[model samples]
Target: MKLLKLVPDDTNIDFMKWRKIAFGISLALMIASVVLVGVRGLNFGVDFVGGQMIRVTFTQTAEAPVAKLRDTVGALGYGSPSIQRFGAPNEVSIRMRLPKEAEGQTGAAATMTNAIVGSIQKDYPGARVDGVDSVSGKVSDELFQKGTIALLAAMVAIAIYIWVRFEWQFGVGGLAALAHDVTLTFGFFALTQLEFDLNIIAALLTIIGYSLNDTIVVYDRIRENLKKYRKMEIGELINLSINETLSRTVMTSLTMVIVLVAMLLLGPETIFGFTAAMTLGIVVGTYSSIYWGAPILVWLKVGPDSFVPVGDKPGAPGRDREGYTR
Candidate 1:
């Protein structure tokens, strides 16, 4: 579990220059992503957009791959099918927009299922259709709304928790960083034209939790340092806090990125979007912790006075490295 060693001494690293560069890059990417989202939009899955999903398993390993199956399914008078491997090589899932021509028919689902199975059989001999699932447009819409609300609820809860844990300023800065990460991740999806599905929503929530954890660690260090060095310039104090926490921050993020990268490369295609979003968040969250959250503390003019003990002079309780209450 110890993938990284914690640095014992705080190294004074000047991250302001890197912060500027990071800001410029993230801003440009975010704007481009927004534009892509507006113009091209995300490739929504059947769960978000109403469609028919058929799960088919081959009797043996599929001689014809999912791409070929998609092509064959498209030739059967259906729209381009979204074909992807399911649990195993023998299992594949296909989703297609519901045919308008079958709107009112009682056996539309059955008819669509049979047609897809027939198409698979024709293209790849010995293919067997396991099951078909259909969701009406209304149901999909409801799920989308529910997922959105849940995300909003989680953000609110996190903000309140941070506010109670530290101060309103810390809460505000942490929330801003959280929003930065989430928006940038959304921008990536929009820019990349990746599929937006229920799993994508889950990935986003995971990002929120992770980004908050990063922000909290930095904020906690800043709060502790603020009480230790009361008269130092706010900017310098913030910079020093970033340096103090930099080692831990980088080590944690780097480890997470390594795991996510492996999953991105070797994991199933179904989670490609999810893992990609997480990978992006891992990088963004780390940057925001320093550049986004730390700068906010500076701009807020936070100093040792913000959390100084009422009965003692500033730095009076500053103990030695032993951490005793002086």
Candidate 2:
């Protein structure tokens, strides 16, 4: 039986021909993201900022709506708790920043949770607290530090892996593409003021893995073609490699995007930020694999000689008569 084909097996598209244009666009967007993040900052969630979070579920459908919950909580003098539907209509999560005086106070979170629960239950009978979590300022600071370290560590590991597996040029290109995907994803979160929590950090790491896998695939093909087509120009070889993997790339990205879109539209508000970030990452990752990752090889001056053994040259170290790196 014939297999399904989303992109032709014999594709010959010149993807690297427009590298300059694509680079320009990516640079502009990255700079804009940096500016937005610097000016507006991220909308950190309770996990990153000290806060008390309460999840409540109503036993009856006659419970108050979201707006009423907000109003009810607001009237309690907590300064308008951030209330939103959690997983279902009957479930809601209320988050409030800890007061200055309440910070570092023992058992403050539990006492606050009890008070909020009591206040809400009075208005809507059968309403009970499903979960309660509290983060202190010290804990939040530690979390932020660890999260940043994890991201940097992941990037460094990826760069080292690529450098060892391929040449330095390929490593640089892969890092560049990963950086582009990550920056754009962060930019999306910053521009939209999405909650920057641990889940979103997971999404960012997931994006790094996905984008790196795609870049490696392209780099592998380029490596093979460099040895086979010695006369081909670097630009032509890069384009050929991308076209060769275009079908697989499109299929993988499309499959991921379909699932991510479903989650974005139907998933709970708690994971909306996660799904949105993943969706953006998939799109950006695919584009960078094609346009940003492979095209950087040209700027790095990676030619056929780069892929050959150092000992292949006459009088080089570790020379061998059979042309193999002895």
Best by lDDT: 2
Each candidate's TM vs. the true structure? Answer: 0.80, 0.83
- Report the C-alpha displacement of residue 238, candidate 1, in angstroms: 1.5
For candidate 1, the per-residue lDDT at 218 reads 82
Candidate 1 stretches with Cα past 4 Å from truth are: 1-10, 17-32, 60-92, 98-112, 124-126, 309-326
Pairs with steric clashes in candidate 2:
none
* RMSD (CA, Å), each prediction: 4.8, 4.3
Best by TM-score: 2
**38-72 in candidate 2: lDDT tens per residue?**
99889887768789988999878744377778778
Q: For candidate 2, give the lDDT of residue 244.
A: 89
Model 2 C-alpha RMSD vs. true structure (Å) is 4.3
